[model samples]
Target chain A: MAHTGKILVTGSGIDLTLLRPLEEAGNSIVARPKLLSAAELKAELRDAVAYLHGGEEYASGDALSTAESLKVVAFMGIGYESFVDVDAAKERGLRVTWTPARRPDAVAVFTLGQIIYANLGIRNRLDERYPPQWSAAVPMPSELSAQRVGIVGLGSIGSRLAGLLLTIGCEVSYYSRTRKLAETTLDLTYRTLPDLAAWSDILVVLLPENPSTVNIIDTSVFARMKEGSILINTARAALVEPVALGNALRDGTIAVAAIDGHYRDESVNAALMREFGPRLLWTAHVAAHTRQSMAAMVDQAVRSVLRALDNAPDENMAVGQ
Target chain B: MAHTGKILVTGSGIDLTLLRPLEEAGNSIVARPKLLSAAELKAELRDAVAYLHGGEEYASGDALSTAESLKVVAFMGIGYESFVDVDAAKERGLRVTWTPARRPDAVAVFTLGQIIYANLGIRNRLDERYPPQWSAAVPMPSELSAQRVGIVGLGSIGSRLAGLLLTIGCEVSYYSRTRKLAETTLDLTYRTLPDLAAWSDILVVLLPENPSTVNIIDTSVFARMKEGSILINTARAALVEPVALGNALRDGTIAVAAIDGHYRDESVNAALMREFGPRLLWTAHVAAHTRQSMAAMVDQAVRSVLRALDNAPDENMAVGQ
Candidate 1:
């Protein structure tokens, strides 16, 4: 029946229609399109059953301290690495859930698209101002089948991306925290981070953002990469140092860099623009924002919230399932 | 033991080293990197046994008449369609050879890249001018898995393109010259040109250039296309009319157009720039110019020329074989 408890929906890009199920289940909804600070959320918190989260809004111990009536907090995105304080939620005996490995298809597709873009030299080949005249202006793009692609993280998105690249005849290797059991169907090799960088013509970053990954791809990593190699980052900005990336692009340490995620700080974008200009293919964190993937994620998040309110067991909810 | 006849190499983007087999086979080489006119080629045609062609160099009845010692004319690129005077060469008893369907891999890869580009809305997603504020400046791109794609002319490149699209979860249908016997492995449907246009969210052109295909994608075809559907062309310039494309893009009959081939006449480029500008993803005719593909083509062309000089049968010299 009517669950009378209020649901605080906080996210910038989630479809509101997804919350209609919660409303139909008889819960009142307060949707916040922009991320509010912990103190601001605390001030507005009242008789809330759950908080459906999106964006970079923090749920720190101090914030959770004020969430007196909060039963659950669920994220509509895959990563819950740096964005949320899971420890704090656990301390308060509050359940925290996130759509882990959600939208891998969208992210993997975006990564594959960037790989195609760089390998085909689409940016240089398609510039209208300077028409490519074959050998003179447009040298042939490197074939995908001939290039070695190295991915930093062998997570869900990375594994899916590897499968896609393998379909296109790309040789795939990855560096993850642990080695996956050999799949006879996949011609994938596991390598050390430095070895992967040295061996690859194109290095892709898809690591989750955490203390260990922050500034992981620094000058040292860039120095190890092959000369005129390309770097593509669709992961978090914390994984790459802005100044080092800019320097690498300028000094030709890397031929081109396609970056999708950033720190949500304008200065980072401005710095990349000032240094790389058209050389840097930048997208404002919309890689996982495809119509189908986004809808699936929002549905997952909403269902998780509803399940939590119904006092369903924790085993019942997981990301994208 | 040696074929001492000279070979005239003409093309803008050919890798010269591919002709080494001809030299090894005892043929002298005279390469003119620029496209030579009928009169200009006539002046240089003395004692030439083969014409290694590239670009739009015409070997007319008059030109072939002047090529007194010319036994064969071979092209380093695919499509001997409108560029070569096949009838004139046949009448003159001159063997006409081209690397037809030679670089289908390259073209297919490029088409896949363009498909990813249009489906992901990469141009708008990556535009730095309008800072995306999530669902405002940049909405979620259409999913590759969710879009219905239509291909015109399911020839070599188109069929290969179809396979790649299928790999990435796109529903593919095509209007080819003839139906490929139902392939259970491939989830492709055969459709009439008009029906395909109406049914698609994206239209791709990879038709070979011929009298029937010239200006085939006119205003009527665009009129039939879905309102927000995208169009991609990496085939021949003659397949789609430029003015109709511009009008379609302007009137919202199409959402985006990623074109890689066009009439060498700069007028088409100028007009598209004037009308669509950023909306049109324009690339010079470099879709089939991957290093591996180019090398394969030039090798085939030179070998064809050498074989013709050696009095080999014409049956073995057909293109795309």
Candidate 2:
């Protein structure tokens, strides 16, 4: 059983609550502290059947390619692109799967929370606490109900976000890939991206990053935007051209913006700050991170491993279920 | 008419939006640039007919005692204790009036927002953006439905906070000065402060500061609190005794706490940080500062000023309005 070489769980920040079943079933589990560089990773994966990619494994591409004996790579999230080399892994008879990183409730709550915090100026209040007995600097942020919110993508997160925004009396509209069916929970209107930009007092980027969406919010989209609008990004960074965003912020094209998902490094955030200015309220890529979601993600990961061990079929796989 | 004598609004951050009406009413309003000290304020108020207190004006009794012909000491807010000698002003035929600050909508929004941020670990995501990358932090925050909340000092802000919390499925309980009448909007159980502390997973303090309430949450209260319970103070700082709070957090008797109304200076916050570990989230007194509330506050201020002009007899008169 020790020589079975059944599974490998790579990365940190993973809840091992679900992975216990496979370990209990007498399948050999190879656990690294977290994802190391390619050399260190190659040393760890001498005999592992299925590969698990957690948060850190997605940082770079080198360690991913070295897991030679890996048959399946089941990502703990919908973002398999970060860790899975689609082209390289396809050539190696490797099947990649993902748990749709959809925590609609969590994201909806967070969106509403940030909406109030941004509108109500929680950051300014926090900063006032760090001062020289000064209280005049805090900006009393405005109300979201009085704000016109335009979302670029009306997919799952965006649609749910639209509902939350509506509950707070925000005027909501969105741009989607295809026309939506009919009337829905939110008072939503479909508009061209540019038109949406022009109308919105706050433009939140929630579009998925694909060939169509890559830098979709470039100069033209920003050029049509209202002067004092705020840009909030919980989506992929590349969805908006960073250069255009910086220029927009600098030139009074936007008043102030708050973001929850951007680069996970200081240098990157610093560069973003240099360009976009420190006015960007930042959080790491944790838009949908509720404990419920993480626990659900681990359950899915364990199922994938158990399926592979039992040689049974698993559906709902992102790339190849 | 020009010699009506200048009504000196000496406090900085004295609602510009509110003063617009006074300016338009032909009352020449000269706005101060900053929160002035007692000496600077005396110089500024040499010829002032009425002096508005923005923050604490004097540390001692004589500051207000010696000022002759300072007829009205009008306040922009309810915290007149910070800036005025109420009894002394009464003796001097100096009328001091204040706008009662209450914003259920704003406090409801902020309390819920901070609660979500705290129990859900919003700062973790904020921390994830920097040196400790998002992936390195595991067990992402939990959802609100899973949290157990307790409210202390269930006054206006706390009561409204409880209503909001109940609407969102929080296991809400409260401890007020007296028991509240039954209301289904908040299925709130009235608990003794000790019972509330013991049963609550998160304790939200919304008490006012006074001799009776000061250090009310000292070692005994912290000891009564459940392990890993969080403390939130949008009310007053003296409600919590920091030494006990530090000990609780350090020994894991309590987990973390957030205070938005305690520190008057960064040095005080810094001193707290030095005394207590950084498990505390310190912010300036800005819980009731949405734009809507600011506008409302200023509106009330204008009304008070106008009521004096209207020559209407009214109740709750501070400075013989």
**Best candidate per DockQ, number?**
1
Tens digits of per-residue lDDT for model 2, A133-185: 32444445666667899888776678777765665567998888787643265
Q: What is the iRMSD of the candidate numbered 2?
A: 4.2
Worst 10 residues of 2 chain B by lDDT: B129-138
List the TM-score for candidate 2's chain B. Answer: 0.83
Model 1 chain A poorest ten-residue lDDT run: A312-321
Q: Model 1 residue B215 lDDT?
A: 89
After superposition on all CA atoms, what RMSD does each candidate show versus the true structure? 3.7, 4.5
The iRMS of model 1 comes to 3.1
Q: Model 2: DockQ against the native?
A: 0.34
lDDT of 1 by residue, B1-321 (tens): 435678888765677777788888888888786657679887776679888877556566777777778888886565665767777777777777877647577888888878888877787667443224566545667788778999998767787788877877888999987887533457589898999999999999988776778889999999898877899988766688878987898888888888875566767778777768777788767787788988888878777877787777544364322
